[model samples]
Target chain A: MAKKKKAFDKLQWIAAYKSFVLEKGELPATVRELAEMAGQTFPDFKKQFTDLRQLETAVIALYFKEANDLLMADEKFEEYSNKEKQLAFLYVMIEKAGADEVFLQEFQRLKKTDRGFAVRLMRFLNRQELSWAELSWGASTAERVGVNPKQAALIQHALSTLMFFLKDYSEEKQDTDAYIEKTTDVLYRLTDTSTVRSMVDLGKFLFSRRKTTFSWE
Target chain B: MGQDKIAVSKYQRAGKLVNTGAKVGANYMKHYAKKLTGSKATKQDLEEENAKDDYSAFSELKGGPLKVAQMLSMGDQVLPKAYVDQFALAQNQVTPLSLPLVRKTFRKYFEKDPLQLFDEFSTEAVNAASIGQVHKGRKGKQEFAIKIQYPGVADSLQSDLRLIAPIATRFLGLKKKEVAPYFEEVERKLMEETDYRKELQNANEIISGCGNLEGIHFPEFDPQLSTDRIITMTWLKGLSLNDWLATDPSQEDRNRIGQLLWDFYQHQFHLLRVIHADPHPGNFIITPENELGVIDFGCIKHIPSDFYASYEKLMRSGQEQDSPELIDALFALELLHDGDSEKDQATIMGVFGSMFQLVGQPFYSETFDFSNDSFFEKIYSTGMALSKDSSYRNLSARGSRHFIYFNRTYFGLYQLLHQLKANIHTGQWTFIAA
Candidate 1:
């Protein structure tokens, strides 16, 4: 991927936020919202980008943060990581826009305000949700320990989810301990053979345990 | 009296004798009454027609648990011999695996034909089980046994079960609030049985659990060949328990082999909460070394946390009989019928108490000599007689959802033991101490 350009200074970044509000017809999202859309504070997120646009460049990133919070609370994601969190967020976004007519309507109403917001939001929406892109996650045997490309990819997907789900994940606090422990387990299992193999039941075991089922219509 | 009244008919007497509550008998009457009264269709005549219908439906469902129907058919033998003869025409005519149906299922699941994936596949099935059939073939250098479940079997499960059940809520009854949990359990276990994936998990878990133990063995799964409808595993060697017993093995050999099954189950309960819930003698094969090769991992019941607590309590009781604890255990299992009368509860408990005594029999002594048919006959006769009691009916519906397979499995194991005439070390081989 080419390095994304068009960096914004703090004020220009503030102006972009203004433009976003002017177009979106909502109050300028709070700094807490700005610093926390990806569930990361601005300082902690700087490794990915130095400028404020890194946070505000994408309007759907804010929406991703809001929905990702809900997905995090779900039982399935009890022990997800940052990469996994992002992919899950992406999946939610795609499934929501593709399948939910009402959500698409609300999104369209906001898009009518400006083409720029519309284009960016549309691109982010479901770019890969229903696609067989994450087939690895869809139908895979247990994760192999250490660094097979498959394991690395799966772990990256998990880590991205954590980075995008739990705000202040790096903060050393008692309350944050739950999130920490969960991510640790998911990460550890990504590298643990017995847990992965046993749970997956390897290549053949997956089929015998499954009932003949048609996908949801 | 001026004139003798017309003699009462024999059919009239039978109508008075049979229970109106038994819908099956009433249904039999209603069907036969038409043909019997009509010159063209007597009761015997109607049975012949019904037999034809049952045969077609059985073939249609692709073997829809017709064995349950077959068992009920045996009970129907008490009817007049002519009626029994007509009913005997019903044959479990299962069709062999057709290449087209096999291809369609493969394409539907994998987006490709089975022939493309599986080379040198067998169209003929070597054996049939409750849910489906198994075909022996080769995927490559590795030999495989591909299992194909009949089509549309899942849709017919509820109707098939309702048709087989002695009493539905319509004949007997259950609480309105209680229906959801009760049927939810039956549907769940049956669904589990339908899922070949769950079976694969069970196969692996069992392989992991007791694979290394001497005189105890099971098959390892090869996953690429498996799907939701089909299970592929490495071909296993040896004859099943029924085959071995038919050969008339010596008492020493029978006892040693029986000990392996007992020990294997014991190891599962203490080491893993999973219980192998299938009891068909064919599932257990005897090898040359006398090692028991257990196949067919289709029905497995994993003991949930709550049930384990009850099990712990039941195991703790020394007298080998504790009514309150057992009821508590049943409660954990969701077995207690919510609106059962005291008489009903006691009768059900009495049945359970007898079985507890039987299972615990081995715990008291060094070994269990199952060659004695009388001991098993007592248990069987007791269960069958208990089953006939009107109030004890619908008890299965009231029982815990998860425990259905587990409970059925114990009866199956005892029956298997009796048939094998195997003597097993019950006290040393199980969780009786715990």
Candidate 2:
């Protein structure tokens, strides 16, 4: 999320994009096509934008906007700690805004000969996801989980794998039942603490809903 | 002994053995590689290399250790169908060891005859292992498994490593300074493998260190019968996870076994502070109840306290885009080096970095599912790529480090579990990490 002028006329650009799309409503476009739509010369367009996804990324700011508004509108997400509340806020925002679908369609359009939005989409999800879920397991989580740092990292690594698997899975909604089921299965066996209830449980619920998956064999 | 045998002098015999063994090795891998990748390759090409290697080793493969080395290394990656078809037909493939050689191994390592100790010694080998053959016998009421070293195996190792060095380097692209760490690590492990006494010590340490771990089994040692060349452990029986998984076990079965395997490794990597570094399938047995039986402590890989700690940091740093600092730390830890040229270093880094990302992915997971073929493929393909780099022209003498055996062992074991589709959360990693 970069700062834009408070009174900048972004709507005007959107209107222009719509007009362009009216005649050029293809699934996605290459850098050449995007340059043509924007009424800019190819060389200048390439200079202005390193990739076509830069344009799509500019538009993706809208989803983040929707997410932010949803977060501001909801108060229950505020009841948790800084980390949990942040995750809860993002979870609710994405769910309410159909964030996954919007981003998927946007990404499909932006993925061309070279410009890939998958990493950008990942960067966005990662930016907003607001959980250490994707990061390597470190001392803090290891202590909380009662495993050595390496083993903790390994477990966390497994969770991250399921996250990647979810990205490639073709399904409706998200599921964390199995993730929770699987997580708690290992969690309970290792430690007797109930402290991971909210954090681990929430991760399970959201991630498992999308389809808890990945083949190890 | 026959006096009519060619009277090649000691140097001549050594030269012949070394050359023959080297050619045999070179030919086997080339032939095995062709057979495994048989798209454009023909039976003639396959047999041609096999013959070349066999012809080279013809003078030395006479009941020596090279035969077993061939078998184990062949099992490494997927062997081509043609090679399997060709080799499978040669049923009694390995050189048959003479009774005198077995007696001599006992006499040299332990001042006794093997048959003098065991209640009944089978003159015939029951099954062939990577570097040895198994003989069945009974001591009191217990059935036993005896792993007998091939005669002159000790003599074969240096030559094998020499022949293996150049190709292995090309396979992995290891450089000079890099060679010392890798081979130092490998030699240390290899030494334990050669010295059955050290392996016996390893077996005792691990069994006692892992005392009464539920679902874990260790064979009782008999010092009266053990020796430097032969290790006699109680013969245990069960289905390998490979065989078990092939039957398409339920997720419950997979998870149970996966968890056990994970827990066992965690214990070794952490508390015992020593690892049973061998990844050979024969080292493990998975039972009907999902119990894991680990044997063969001969291939033990050791980690200094500081090295393990540094390695833990390295594993953690690898999770993010932290290569610069990671490289620095790795250099500090001697895991990576500027040993080769700058370009070569960068190329090796790029190759290994990608693999680190893949292998390290499970570090972020709740638990890695060993059965995932895609995950396995990612790591395996990356490894194959890493091995094929020209920058590692001298890997054998350079890259064969002790620290690397852990990674190699795990890679091999994980491939087996990957096929089984086991979903082990490895709960005990948490306990060990604690």
Candidate 3:
């Protein structure tokens, strides 16, 4: 009974995290405030995390975890190729984010203002990259591909690029669908031809360095 | 196909129409001016000049204007032989959307370059039509034919029809109100044709309806690759009727292929009351094995139950030698209206009723030989004489609106089988209502 209560409590805070972002147009000003808004105390909020910054990181982490859970629950996931799995991941993430235009815009604005916010984005990218690598290479093939920083960076760049489009995608999302299909195709091609020569060329001058110039794909 | 981009903008399209109208007006003024000056410009000279301008305008502006031109060109009762022959070429001469425009169209609906969707996608269109163009594509081991519609065709068809109404009225010698029904019918079908999603639905319905049948094939449509303006389907393998004819197939081959077409139409019209409306030679492919391959479900006509029953009544009246009954059927079908005097009604019935007799002749016979040269000669000459007749011209310039596609399909079939020089079992529809 106590374990079930704890799980339910965690869910309440997650739901509160989403509603707070949606209603207040931002995360709580502080953990105590979040606790107060969620109808909990600071001690209770601290049980889940050490600080407000960790809670913010958890909010981003929750999105990926939910998407990954969906991927696992899907019966057809095993039938898809590694590239297809990555594409499926994108669709799942977009669906779960449920973050509408205002949420996306506010997050984007926050991105521009907060330098520390870059660390949260990097964490998100790293998690996505690891998920992609694990699905794409599996345990046996992953060692053959090696732990090349360039390969990791290329995926990071690709995910970061995809997020930018997903953030600004209109309600119809016809443009976003095209962007996902096209960018993933380019990523698949780059990964398939990942060799010493390709990796060297990629790493030498920001290989997979999507022009730092930001634009919707 | 011309290298120039298709005119999609309403203003640019209107500009083309205005230019055509200006030329026609200028030609008329020149004819009068020549007469006033006592120049030696014959009526034939003036006609040829106007025909040139009309063809250039309709054929050059290749969307709804060109489609209207093709319809008018096929109207034996409307255009002069010279104009008909000239405008018929408009069906062949079309301006394709450029590569950049095709890509842009794909992006608008699909949000991806077509190249990214398929392993191989042709840059140039293989077949370009008034509403869309088709490209060859391949994904993995599968081949596909992807159709990309010109942007804004759905929005522009209405305005285009409005602009062409007056011009079609003058050439066809009809009042504006009389011409409105024909253009409205054409517009309704054109709007449906421009919608690829609807075409996809039609394709599925047709495939299901015809699945168990032999000697006919409908391409498999991929919903994943299809949108409102774009459709990707499994590529059909066969030769177009003209290309197949060029290969000099045997008489047996011709007869076999012709029979497939005949039976297909009979089944659709009599049982289903639905027929493929656009039946030009391009929409049919005569396989090397003498089977028929039907493509382009873009335009389909569903004959209402009452209309079909009344049409059958007209045929039955013709069969029973009941002139009064035949006249009543015509009126019921809206072929002949209420206002005509008895004498005018008789003359109108005599003219159109004879045309119906010729159309019904095949069904009356056990097997009909389309290779009868004199029979075809009579069809053409009689059509020209009836169209050229002054008495018929005085009648209203409309018939049953369904007659537009009803006549198109039968006439197109007659012309096609005649070209094939085949003998067919036209007796299939005799027991249809049974």
lDDT of 2 by residue, A55-167 (tens): 55545445445555655564433443332332333333334334345334443443444444545644443333322332212224322433344334333433343343334
Alpha-carbon local distance difference test for all models: 0.54, 0.53, 0.71
lDDT of 1 by residue, B1-434 (tens): 01111111223212322322244355467776766676454556555555554443443333233534332233221233443343333322344433334544565567765556767666556776546777777677866777888544454455455443334445445554556665566566776777798889888987887777888867768787787788888776778776788888898888788777777877776678788876566678788877788888877878776666676666555345545776677666555567777776776677667766765565678878877766755665666666677767646456556655565665566656666678877876444332
DockQ score, prediction 3: 0.02
Q: Give the alpha carbon lDDT tens digit for every residue of B1-434 in model 3.
A: 12443443468778887887799889989998999999988777777788889888776566687777766655433455567667767755665554544555575667887778889988678887777788999999988999887655666677788777776688768888877887788889988988899999888866677766789987899998898889989888889887899999899999998898898888888777788877777778876567889888988888888788778888888754437787788788876778878877778778766776766789889899988877766777788787778888777875778888888878778777877889988875663553
Please rank every candidate by TM-score, starting with the best: 3, 2, 1
lDDT of 2 by residue, B1-434 (tens): 11012112235445655675577577657766876887566656755566445433432332222333433333324443344334332323343343434544565557666666777877667665434667777867888888786534444454555545555555555555545555555555555576778888989888888877898877777776776757788877777555666687788877776676667777788787778776555567786567888877877766677667667766767655546766665665654555556765665466557867777666567777776667755655665665566565433232224356666556555655665567766433532343
Runs in model 1 lying further than 4 Å from the true structure: A1-217, B1-64, B67-93, B107-119, B139-141, B158-167, B170-180, B318-355, B387-398, B430-434
TM-score of each: 0.52, 0.52, 0.62
Q: Give the Cα error of residue A1 in candidate 3, in Å.
A: 49
In model 2, which regions exceed 4 Å deviation? A1-217, B1-93, B100-116, B166-178, B240-251, B323-328, B335-353, B384-400, B427-434
Instruction: Write the candidate numbers in order of decreasing lDDT.
Output: 3, 1, 2
Top of the candidates by lDDT: 3
Top model by DockQ, which number? Answer: 3
